[model samples]
Target: MISKSTIDQVYETARLEEVIGDFVQLKKSGANFKGLSPFTDERTPSFMVSPVKQIWKDFSSGKGGNVVAFLMEHEHFTYPEAIKYLAKKYNIEVEETQRTDEQKQEANERESMYLVSEFARDHFQHNLWESELGKAIGLSYFKERGFEEETIRSFGLGYCLDHWDDFTKAALEAGYQLNYLEKTGLTIIKEGAAEGESNRKFDRFKGRVMFPIHSMSGRVLGFGGRILGNNKKAAKYLNSPESEIYHKSKVLYGIYFAKKAIAKEDNCFLVEGYTDVIQFYQRGIQNVVSSSGTALTPEQIRLINRLTKNITVLFDGDAAGLRASLRGVDLILEQGMNVKICTFPEGEDPDSFAKNNSLEELQHYLQENSKDFIQFKASLLAEESANDPIKRADTIRDIVNSISKIPDTIKREVYIQECAQIMNISEQVLFNTLAQIGQKALSDAGKKAREAQKAFEVVKSEPVQEKIDLQYELERKIIEVLLLYGNEEEEFEDLLLRENEAGDLVLEPESMAAKVYEKIFLDLQEDEIELTHEKFRTIYYLLISSLSENEDFSINTFLTDLDRELVEEVSSILMEEERYTLHQWERKDIYPKEKQAGVSQLVSETILTLRCYLIKKRIHSLQQNTEGSSEDHRETLEEIMNYLQLNTLLNKKLNRVLS
Candidate 1:
């Protein structure tokens, strides 16, 4: 268990915007920050973060909480892991009690795999720096590639021994499980020949250099190993197999290091191999990542999309390789990103180019040589289809197809014009092709929709509309008022029932000054009314207790002690009205009332509305009881009449007419 003081320190030191901003690019909007929903595939910004409250909400997914909750949701971290991450980020020392063997073993499969992978990374690095064979072969290989010691260490480059079972033995001796080792693809286990024989284990990356693949938040997900020797049958580069924690298509190499720089530069430099990414960063270009030699994936693109809308794909001089990589540009375009392509000269890749040139030269080359996708694609294709009318027509259609992938109509049109000039074709021809492709895509989508509809044909009922729960809403409003203005002192009008001189029972209004929470708590207690919603009831009691006990209570600090569900509830209640701020209502000359200006009135109305609702419910129950009971009904009827009069009087005080 982590010490409570450390947890409190983390909550105080970790800024919500700064923590979430590492993963999602956030822009200032009003008093808060808005960004594309990291939880959902969205083009519009709906994820909001309020630094004042230290809470965040994803309107698309309905997930909201404080900083720790965001980490748990986005990074899939355990509670302790999230706190540790924050502690590390904020440079705070974590004071945690040691766990027992059983407690350590109780970690889930995914977490165990992560642990194994991290251990493997450490073991490999130790081999590179400490072991004799590692220093000669692994360390030598990195140095020969012009990677300095710091560069090698920063990327966690390491070497695996030639002996097949050396790593497996070390892991087993360290009390790490062979199950997780094999699951993470660090160790390969084979069954023995005989029943009594033990299973044999081998290091999967034996005789290789290791590169640890990390998640965006810097957890070691897996490894990519490059073979050292020129073995005829062995694959030159190998990656950790798909496991519970590592998915290559979704993971981008160097993202953990490059995320902040990518956001800062407003552009990501895309390369092919691990060395390419490392070399560029070593050359002082920090906003670069690699695809790890895999074909670009939509998931990878979305990862970059979170940081910036611009991507510059760096390619080698190999003609075939360059042509093969063009497909990734279309993927970037489909995600509504601007893509520029840059290629090194013949016999040079990003790794060699960065290694040879100074930082200024490399940066200058990229700026001067990077070409827009339209110009690059059209020029590359025009050379192949020179004086060939049929191939030219196909090339025109191909360019239009790539343009169609762009989501912005203006960008698509602009690219079409550029393609017309490059390919010497009419702009109309490209637009017509674009329209035809779009129509076909729509037709195919419609067909899929109709086929999906066929599966539900037996269910002919219309979707049920949910009726508004007035009591629940009123209860929610009461909680909201208490959370917002609980400690605020205000004058309130108290309604007392008295007999008039004319012999009629009437409401006598009197004035009293009390805190908002005091007024709400007293009003609810006087009526003996409790919130019906379980969540609301629990939070109500907590709020009341907290308000009464602490003279210096803060919602942010109070939220730290609650579980994720309760924290989410409180955040939703507090941020419910913040949605209206996103619309910039004042900019349209439409001024809305501020809740803070009328906290006193808001409290009184919420309590009065709850009283009226409860009274009406009681009257209804009494009326129903009188209908079927054979017992005396006069008392019930009179009780209903009295409740009805009280309900009417409360509603009138609220300026609500009761029918």
Candidate 2:
């Protein structure tokens, strides 16, 4: 419902690099930014972001699109949601047309859950700030923990009322559905078995201080609650049960606040608790997030890896916790992330230490304390071994094994040297251990891959393949021509589509893309059915509207609008891997040439030329296929003449280019 101007503002303001740079650490790769793929598990970066095109393509996952499209695909934002996100990012005021009550009432269960969670957060905040009990108990607790009012508001922290059913009553009176409240785990619903009432709803986090868990894009996913009241049998901290909108394993606390800083710093600090992250950020270290309580997952590490190659694990100095957390460092390394370990002094956690120091002082301490994972591990292990050769040797091998997980071949070599320096072992011995573990892992992976491939073959079979008719080739070519040469002016002797469509087709046919599409659709209308190829048909219709409906005729825009599979195929065709022209341009000292113009222009032109050629070839083929069906000489002669004329026109255009 956003106004046209608002939508344009969102799209225009969304700089591709700026938007993507919030999540991925991008280094300039030619004119584009290249970084590790966010879509897949990969070490070497094949993802490319083009500022000029206002789009990005992940060669690994084959997902390519404009900035809004990227957010939609990567972050799962709906189209309007994506535009609003961009608008918010750029701090632009948005103007959206109001939806009707019926429209608003049609909220899906997932969106409804999110709505209820957001309301619960607001209710808690109001209590924290306005109510006496909340200020005395809940708000005081956060302050006692050293949280500033701004930090509390920024994190959306709040207090659930100590009275049971207080939240439940307010939400129901506000016309919010009780079903959504229960579904979101904000309220507990019990169906009547022996009770007089059919249903009962009560606040799930009553008497608790709230931590609103957020997705990277800052959407409220669920809540984590810390009990404020003394209940002897109750646990101190509890999280909302898993719901459709909240998956604990996939969600990380503080990511919403930390993502931008993480990208800016080109590193992420992994800590263990909500306060740990809040304290670090409060201490001017903004690029920090906590696993919240889950054992370190590859998924969690991969989330960090998307932003940066380097990660620093901040652990408490407890010997048991430090040892347990070291295993998480291995997970980071396996994702090709460089890791360092920093443990605070015994009896002191990040929250206390940071509160006691200024930002600069805290940063200085971090810089001095941070040690390369290999060095830290060796030192810690050596102290534990105490000259026991077997344990020492085992520690060396374990360090080597961690080193082997680095997917970058060059990095593996560098880490091997570090391993030698720290453990005081021969580089050859460490290298030998790395190779042994790496080879075994790869062999095991290969065996599993082969087994999966065989299983896939047994379960699935090839569909009845559609033979590529000449028309299919022609249709594709026409689309290509329209996209590339649509804006160009051409002096044409035969503007056949325009002439024939003097009545029904009122199109001005401003661009080559439009003209070609109009001509083909007009010509094809005589056929009994539309294109048999479902994907092709969709593209065909889309291309027609691309020209007939809009004036800008942006190929990148069109590519973004298409379905994902078609978008990938079209983008790969458009973004040819033959980057020789780009390399050659670099040698010419073009000095920061604009991105995608040269590449996309060339692609668009090639498709047009191919299409014009194929259209004539298709008419000839079709004439031949239908020739024997009609024995009448006059009808046959007329068809032959039409085919010849189209051929002559096509050949002339082809010859001009090919020559």
Candidate 3:
């Protein structure tokens, strides 16, 4: 468990915008920050962060809370893990108690796998630095690759011993479970034993140097290991098998280190392999990541999309590799991102080129060599189709198909013009080809939609519109008012029921001065009312007690003590109108009334509405009871009449006309 003092300090020191900004790119909007929803696939900005309130809301997914909550949702960190991450980010010392054996065993399966992966990472790093065989093999290989010690350590590069069960044995001895070890693909198990014999186990990355693959928040999800010796029987690069924690297609190498730089530069340098990413980053190019030797995936592209709209793919001069990577450029275009391609000299790849050139030379080479995707594709294809009319025509259609993948019409048209100029083809011809491809794509999409509809046609019906829950809404409003203005002192117009000279019931108005929370509490208590919703009820009492007790209360500090569910609830209620506020209505010549200006009236109206609703409910219940009652029917009728009259008087005082 983390000490409360440390957690408090972390909450105080860590800024919500700064923490979430590491994962999602945030742009300033009015008094807050808005960004594309990291929790959802969105083209528009709906994720909001309020630094003043220290809470965030994602309107797209409807997830909202404070800094710690964002980490838990985005990074999948446990509460303690989130606090530790914040502590590490802000350079605060975390005070935690040592977990007992039972506590350690209490972790869930996914967390257990994470713990095992983390342990394996540390064990491998220790082997690389301290073990004799590791220093002679893994350390020597990294050194020969021109990776400095600091770079190696920063990326958490390590080594696994050559012996089959060396890593497996070490992990077992360190109190790590073999089940998790096997699940994480650290220890591969083969079952081919007789009744008395045990299943065989061996290290998955034996005789290899380790490169830890991390999530965007820097958790060790898996690893990419490269074999050292000439092993013609084995693959050169091996990755951890798919587990609950690691999916290769969704994982990018060096993203944790590159996210900030990518967002800062507003561009990302995408490469092919782990070494390519490491070499470029070591040479002071920080905004770079790799697909880890796999073909580029849409998932990986979306990862980079979260940070920037520009991707410059770095390729070596191998002809086959260059052709294979052109498909990724289309994928980037489909995502509405700008893409450029840069190739090294004919004999070099990114790793070798960066090793040979100084930082200035490497940076200058990229600047001079990078070409827009369309220009590069046109020139490359134009050469391939030289003096062959059929091939040239096919190439034109191919380029147009790629252009058709772009979502932006203006960009597609601009690229079409550029293509015409480069290939000496008619712009009209290219546009016609683009239209055909787009039409076919739409036709295919329509077919799929119709097929899907047919599948659900048997049970499909019009979606039922849910009726509004008035009582729940009133209860929610009361909580919102308390959260917003509970501590505020305001003069209120108090109403009392009295008998007039004409012997009729009337609402006699009076003046009273009290805190907003005090007036609300007294009104609710007088009516014997309680909130119907469980969450609102809990928060109501919490707010009433806290606001009444503390003269200097803060929502930020108060929220720190609640669990994530309640925190999300409170944030949703508090920021319900944030979207409107973000629009700056006054600037559009639409002056909206401010909530703060009418705090007293808002409180009184909310309580009066609740009272009216409860009275109507009571009257309905009493009328139902009198319908079938055998005894005391007249008494029940009188009670119902009295409640109806009181409800009418309350509504009239609230200026609500009865139908």
Clash totals for all models, in order? 0, 5, 0
Q: Looking at model 2, report the run of 10 residues with the lowest lDDT sum.
A: 505-514
- TM-score per model over all chains: 0.96, 0.81, 0.94
- After TM-score superposition, the amount by which residue 592's alpha carbon in candidate 1 deviates from its true location, in angstroms, is 5.3
lDDT of candidate 2 at residue 628, scale 0 to 100: 59
Tens-digit lDDT string for candidate 3 (468-581): 999999999998888878899999999988889998888888999999899999988887887878999888898888998889887887787788889999999877777775
Candidate 1 lDDT over 65-101, as tens digits, reads 9999999989999999999999999999999988665
The CA-based lDDT of model 1 is what?
0.90
Candidate 3: list runs displaced more than 4 Å: 100-102, 192-194, 459-465, 581-596, 619-649, 656-659
Residue 196 local lDDT, model 1: 95
- TM-score head-to-head 1 vs 3, winner: 1
Stretches of model 1 off by over 4 angstroms after superposition: 456-458, 582-593, 628-632
How big is the positional error of residue 392 in model 3, measured in Å on the Cα after superposition? Answer: 1.6
**Segments of candidate 2 deviating more than 4 angstroms:** 97-104, 193-199, 230-232, 446-474, 490-659
Tell me how far the alpha carbon of residue 339 in candidate 2 is from the true structure, in angstroms, after superposition. Answer: 0.6
